[model samples]
Target: MTETTPFGIDLELDETVAEGHYSNLAIISHSTSEFIIDFAAVLPGVQKARVKSRIILTPEHAKRLLRSLQENIVRYESNVGKIVIPVPSSPGDTGPKMGQA
Candidate 1:
């Protein structure tokens, strides 16, 4: 067997998406004895907030990953304010109606 890397990545996008500015989303899951990863993205300008990158690992790996993310979050919040989750839909504005444009 070939030497394996610690992490692997792949990407999938719509045919029309531009080559530049393409971001990757990775999803990871595991079975009884193996793990899986899937990378996907939502359409451009479409509910990007709902697209989440999932990472799955065994208990030990999960803990390690959590700690790593926590450290990064601390560093990030030190520079910027605490991250706040934004609410969907702009406030104080009605959405555009169909066939009006």
Candidate 2:
């Protein structure tokens, strides 16, 4: 069943979608019109990681997502201390690698 929000939008979640995928790595690529984001899980000692989900958004919506994330991250850090990111071990290694399409 779908629930109507106070703003009069209907939101629905199914069983499979409610049980979400776990993603530790994200690969992002963009073209002239759209942005593609691939979510993957990388396991320790695993040689290869498969992308579990791919999301495509328009350039404008992608920017909106970026802004929303920034705002949420600020609020999260305020409540749970600042999150620290580790530096890459090697010069060739960059954290959370991004690719161009």
What lDDT would each prediction earn against the true structure?
0.53, 0.85
Candidate 1: regions farther than 4 A off: 1-26, 32-37, 45-57, 90-101
RMSD to true structure for each model, in Å: 11.0, 2.8
Model 2 residue pairs with clashes: none
Which candidate comes out best when scored by TM-score?
2
* Residue pairs whose backbone atoms clash in candidate 1: none
> What are the per-residue Cα lDDT tens digits for candidate 1 across 32-52?
754454445545446543323
Q: What would the per-residue lDDT of candidate 2 be over residues 1-101, giving only the tens digit for each residue?
A: 57888889999978898789998888898899999999988777687989999999999999999998999999999999998877888986654444424
Task: Give the residue spans of candidate 2 off by over 4 A.
Answer: 1-7, 89-101
